[model samples]
Target: MILILVKLFQGLYVSNSGEPWVEEAELIRRAQAGDPAAFDLLVERITPYLYRVVRRLASDQNEAGAIVQEAWLRAWRARHRYVADRPLSPWLVRIAVNVARDLWRKKAPLDFADLGGEEIVLPDPVPGPEDQLTRKEALERLVRGVKKLRPEYRMVIALRYDAGLSYKDIASALEIPLNTVRTHLRRAKSVLRLWMEAEDG
Candidate 1:
């Protein structure tokens, strides 16, 4: 899967460290071939973003950290299944999202009321705690409403909206048909819109 999961990501694999964009295809190829250094290189590039993504899905910071580590472990273990031409971040994210979902499912279906806690990194670039606090309370209702969706729906939301991945990228990450990604996005948007409107009322 194409791994350009987040729009605001900081890439360690970029030709220039401070450069936002990176060409990771070769790096992905090497990593897929069981090169530990390659894999480490790839992981180092994505670790912070990976943790943030999991932090949004999981309950607490600690759980998020654990989920991030497990995600890399799972990704490495399943490296043979990777499609190198595709972006690696999405695949890594899919694993992390599923891992978080599985854990959440084991405890409980993620409920609307339970969506609030520490502020999750959203698509927008909020500066810090001061910037986040205002949005946090306002967004909690939106997030909780989103949590009311099916896991599949939420998956799309996280990947497409939160991670800022494209529909094609999401399909690759989810390993589903491209049409399925379209359908999921359509349906999830419809559901979320309706849910949000209701919340507004």
Candidate 2:
């Protein structure tokens, strides 16, 4: 903890800086011990990661930010319960995923905008009109497929693929068995594939 505090003076060893930094589990341990700065540092470390996770699973920039905040707040409240041996990223992700899922359940509707905001960065300045159209159609079909799933199935799809969360993370987030998470993801992909294929046909 002393070394971590010292490093904070130098930017917490930004990941790309090629400097060794405090691991998330240690941060969480300190946070659980009621260290405010430790908790703040932990939040600082994972804010972008949380934002990316929520952005992929849910929609709206402001909404995603809010979800991440909510997740952090919830995590803070439950920090004492965290298992220190397990890495903190998955736990944080699980909380955010649950928060997003709960919000989605309340909304009870998926829209075009909900599936919007995915950034497509291409090096080429221009893609041909046909290629552009192909990409557009593919995205539309993918969104449509997403809209067709049940809420639970949709959550897994969004968390596992869209958000790039592990099956274990999904399980912890959903408070279900690991195998259940796998099943949900497997069934979700199968359903979406069939739906997309049917749409194509």
Against the unseen true structure, what C-alpha lDDT does each candidate score?
A: 0.68, 0.69
Model 1 — which ten-residue stretch has the worst lDDT?
1-10
The TM-score values for the models, in the order shown, are: 0.60, 0.64
Off by over 4 Å in 1: 1-35, 104-137, 177-179
**Positional deviation of 186 in candidate 2, in angstroms?**
3.3
Query: Evaluated with lDDT, which candidate comes out highest?
Result: 2
Model 1 scores a C-alpha lDDT of 0.68
Quote model 1's TM-score.
Answer: 0.60
Per-residue accuracy of model 1 over 1-201 as CA lDDT, tens digit each: 124322223332343356454357766777778787667667767877677666556556667767777788899889889877666777789899778777777775634322222223334648888778857865886677566776666777777776888888878777789888777667666666666667669
lDDT by residue for model 2 (33-107), tens: 999777877876767666666665655566776787788789889988988888787788888877887788778
* TM-score result, candidate 2: 0.64
